[model samples]
Target: MNQAIANLASEADRAEALQLQLEAGETIVELDPKVIHGSFVKDRLDGFTDPKFIELREGLKTSEQIIPVLVRPHPDIKGEYQLAFGHRRVEALRQLGRKVKAIVRNLSDEDLILAQGKENTDRADLSFIEKALFALRLDQQGVRRQVIMDALTITSKGVLSGMISLASSLPTELIEAIGSAPSIGRPRWETFAQLLADPSHESTWRELIRQEQFHALSSDARFERTLKSVAVRKEKVSDEQIIKTGEGRKIATAQSSKRAVKLTIPTKHTGEFAQFLLRKLPDIYEEFAASAANTTSDNE
Candidate 1:
């Protein structure tokens, strides 16, 4: 049993013991949060407004940090360390005005993401959208797909693509504005992605999120309401309708809109009919003006 434990990998060996040691086999040490900088910050936070995060700070206040966070010397700044993972711990400690016990290492960008991803696996804590967005950010940083696959534990390119799609469904700024909806899962987030395909939905989101009422709701409720608004809007528009003549020939395509009527006349057998309508435009305008003038006179 003792030999088997010793043979286990460093990560899985004895996290308690392993976490107590740095990658260089040194013991964990305390560092000031102010001097610590964020590198590959894992959590997409909006001002650390999470109740759970506050819980973390409270927990740490009463106890020792069970998991040692990883940090490295600041690549540019002298005498400062940059955090690779465990951003929340750093943040909470930063707020508490305390030093964090961190494992110092010289980690590359790849090493940082891998370390963060491994820690994530141990916790399995990030929400689906968060993970997807993290994956997307790694891609944006020019990390290799296979390296991402290994770090994310993604099994297939297909799954990776799907996550990327979900992450990119909304603009980054928009998602940040709404905050991370922890209660939101993958299915609903995927639905939200589809809702954003409409340009109007993208435009309307800017308005909806600006409302005080929108901010009053819980994160999950905000996500639900925003997605539902888009869904209802899509339901209202029939999108397109076809008009067929008695002979079963296609006459026109009707597009539904909230404030306008749009019709498309095909150029096949309908070309002559379309020309005839163009010829009547002047008369059509005259009749429309006369009808409007009479209505104005009647109102007076």
Candidate 2:
């Protein structure tokens, strides 16, 4: 009878604490990890083999999840919940087949996204490209630009524009293939985007990413390899050739590469040569065009 009275007292104390929590706009609850679905917009590219995730899983094996995940009652499914944040914790708990401690709230779609993005920003764990892609996904989903900027903590319109542009320029498949390259920054990603501007180069990346060897590499290494694979190798410039008059007096020196020829004329002759080259360019281009047409005809 004394044990039963103690149990009743404990239950009453718990109820009072829960009421306080509700009044403070939060109610902590234990939920089956299986019933909590991930946020609609993904903000991470962490796989099972990811070192951080592995570490989290291993840590959870021994310690309790002190931080509670934020969740909302499932809008569509009765008796289930949708996660707002703490995806890693929920996933770890799910893998361990343990209950998830969560803070339940009533949140609208925008509210959920705001909470999700805020948590990630506070943690400062999402990579540059991951944040960009998340913004892009929110944009694609018709979320207001202001909301996206607020969610990402972006203050400048130009910054937001660049993020969306970078995300839009790359093929989604390629981004997924590369995963989140944490060490790679904006400049390298922009360079990679420029390299892939030629559609033919994308196929090279596609084929390379399909290979088992590429998949074996780490995310950052995969990005490096992919960038190297599609990068245009600059052709070696040929040795300089001397140009001379009929008397063999050197007038200029010319160096040629696959794309261009640079002629270095003495400064004294600059004006005269510039005028002369301008005068002769039309005839030279006509001859070149005729020769190109003949080569094409012969090949056909």
Candidate 3:
């Protein structure tokens, strides 16, 4: 038995070394969890059933598939691996009282950030509201707003901005429901934010949310109906700026036509980077002026 344990440890070590290499840059097959963290046990032993556990339990039992997880070593986290993704898999392992399985990859600091961003962007299971909330957090992290738009494959900045605004405006409970709702999307959330801001129509909006019938309404129709409800009661205006229509509102704002330019230099020019930053500012203004002139000519 002791010899078996020793051999297992050796195999794990070898696997971990290979996985680390993959995380560094090399692309390889998915790795097992024992190789990454030395054990599959979850530190959190909560019995809650969530999407993560469901996927893991089903995948391990019914499907023959290798689940991918991002394992980053935590400075303060001890005993278990920090999950960059696969929150569900980690939890499911805990619930089943079994060893967790994962792909062990060593990621650099920058790579981890990019991984986190892309993981959130690529999730097909995320609801409209969840996507909005995720995007909002990414925006707050000082991740370039356009990065969120591009990486998420959002067609327009307006859709991205609307989601951010919707997440910010809704109540926490409602936000969670929104995240779970099947029919909600960027346009719906943006429209709902406008509706919820109106004091006179708060009850109706609350009812719409409470009953879950909002899912049945088309996004444009819902926004229009909500706005119409508020329009009739304009005399009962509260301190909040009530939107009677989506027009001229901040929700569906247009994207700026500016493209970003990145510059790299040799390590020796470290001191001259400040001058490089200064040199790029005028180019932005020049681009904006040129764009405006083109627009004016097209209109004329």
Candidate 4:
């Protein structure tokens, strides 16, 4: 961060430093164990103090099994390091009481941007909801949507919107719970968030989740049916009646009538067209009610 120290750094290092600052902003750069800065050594520190930083460090420690530390030299800032990528890994290393082994590459300005972009993108630990929030923040920070799309390898704004929308539906506790789980992938997380959005249906959804029924409805057909069933139940309607009416609504006459009288028939019905029609008929139309025409037709 010092001007004189920055002046001493190589042009490549300076450029890299500038780029990193531009992309991710300034922070305390951990010194390379091999190349000491001032009095700092590789295993000099105990652990990070900031709770958020500590959490990030713990996540990194857990993620070390996947990827190791990646670093790029900051040409402008001497005694300062540019994290090319592996932020989580670096945090993990710092947490684990180990020195970060860096590549020490002399990166150009463009390279630094690419590295930050790639690193932020490739090693993101956000859940579906978190990604949406992160992307939304980036969008507000003057980062182009296309740039975010490119960085995240996502094609449509719908995907981002869906994540945000779904997350917006959940309670903070639910969001935190989902975010903490490393095993929950984007798709599952998104689904969970979406379901949680409708509070009336959450209990049923939770029951389904408890029973591990999602496994049985893995296919598209079953999944859609499950969603529809829950949706109907949430609406306080019989799922079977809803499904039946839905099918009928699609193909029924398709005509806009001048006047229509809708009546509720208190019965459960399904199957052939005749059977469905029979269920809707007046009580007098039943075989047992031959003598008295007790029920009046709505549109007679």
Best-matching candidate per lDDT: 2
Residues 85-159, model 2: lDDT tens digits: 989989898999999999899999899999998878766678889999999999999999898888889999899
Candidate no. 4 TM-score? 0.36
Error of 4 at 33 (Å): 8.9
Q: Residue-wise lDDT of candidate 4 within 1-300, one digit each (tens)?
A: 675455445435645755675477444444544432211111111123424457666665655333333455545556666555545456556557767655455665345434555554443433344555545545555566666666556789888666556545555433332233433456765565565465556666556544445534323333344456565564553222222264454222221223533333334332365466666677636654654444444335
lDDT pick, better of 2 and 4 = 2
The Cα error of candidate 3 at residue 249, in Å, is: 31
- What is the number of residue pairs that collide in model 3? 2
Tell me each candidate's TM-score. 0.73, 0.71, 0.48, 0.36
Please estimate how well model 3 matches the true structure, expressed as its whole-model Cα lDDT: 0.54
Using TM-score, rank the candidates from best to worst.
1, 2, 3, 4
Instruction: List candidate 1 stretches off by more than 4 Å.
Output: 1-24, 45-47, 238-300
Tell me model 2's lDDT, rounded to 2 decimals: 0.85
lDDT of each structure? 0.78, 0.85, 0.54, 0.48
lDDT of 3 by residue, 100-200 (tens): 54544566534554555555554445557666766776677676777667646687988788777777787655454333444556666566666667544
lDDT agreement of model 1 with the native? 0.78
The superposed Cα distance between candidate 1 and the true structure at residue 89, in angstroms, equals: 1.1
Model 4 regions more than 4 Å off: 1-84, 103-130, 168-173, 180-191, 198-300
